[model samples]
Target: MADTNAQEDFSKLTADLAVLRADVAKLADTLTTLARSQGEAAADAVSSRVRQGKAKAEATASELMDEGRAAYDEARERAGKIGGDVTAVIERNPLGAVAAALGVGFLIGLLSRGR
Candidate 1:
């Protein structure tokens, strides 16, 4: 009876070990699959963020370009207006304009010689 009981216990233990080994293998497979999916998800999130950042940067650059163009246009318009005003003044007083030009030239020459 003792021998029989021991044999039965041994068989049961062997069977239990086999089942435990299978369960451990299944757990490892599950963990591997979970890790692979998580890595892929992380990569996708990073890619999406990069795309959003790129679009935002492009939009900012476009806005800056538009602002630059507007500023240039305004500057050009103001310069045109000032040029017209100066022309009118010069036309109204040709002799005065000539005298002013000579005076300015003389002053500039004097200053440059000192330097």
Candidate 2:
């Protein structure tokens, strides 16, 4: 009777160990799957943020380019107006303009000699 009882207890212990090992393996697999999904989610979120930042930067650069073009146009218009006014003054006073030119040239020559 003692031998039969000992044999049965040994068999029961062996079966419990097998079940425990299977449970541990299943737990490990679940943890690995969960980690993989979380990593993928994080990567997707980072990519989305990068795309949004790129779009915003492009829009800002476009606005700056437009402003630069407008400033260039305004400067060119001002230069044209100033040139027209100078032409009119020269037309009104031909001899006086020539005298002024000679005076400027003489002053520049004096300044160059000093330098």
Best by TM-score: 1
Compared with the true structure, what per-residue lDDT tens digits does model 2 show for residues 47-86?
Answer: 9999999999999999999999999999999999999998
TM-scores, all models, native as reference: 0.76, 0.72
Q: List the residue pairs that clash in candidate 2.
A: none
Q: Candidate 1: misplaced stretches above 4 Å?
A: 1-17
Quick one: best lDDT, which candidate? 1
Give residue 2's lDDT in candidate 2 (0 to 100): 95
The stretch of ten residues in a row with the least summed lDDT in candidate 2 is: 106-115
> Model 2: how far is 73 from its true place, Å?
1.2
lDDT of 1 by residue, 1-115 (tens): 9999999999999999999999999999999999999999999999999999999999999999999999999999999999999999999999999999999999999989954
Count clashing residue pairs per candidate. 0, 0
- 11: Cα error in model 1, Å: 5.5
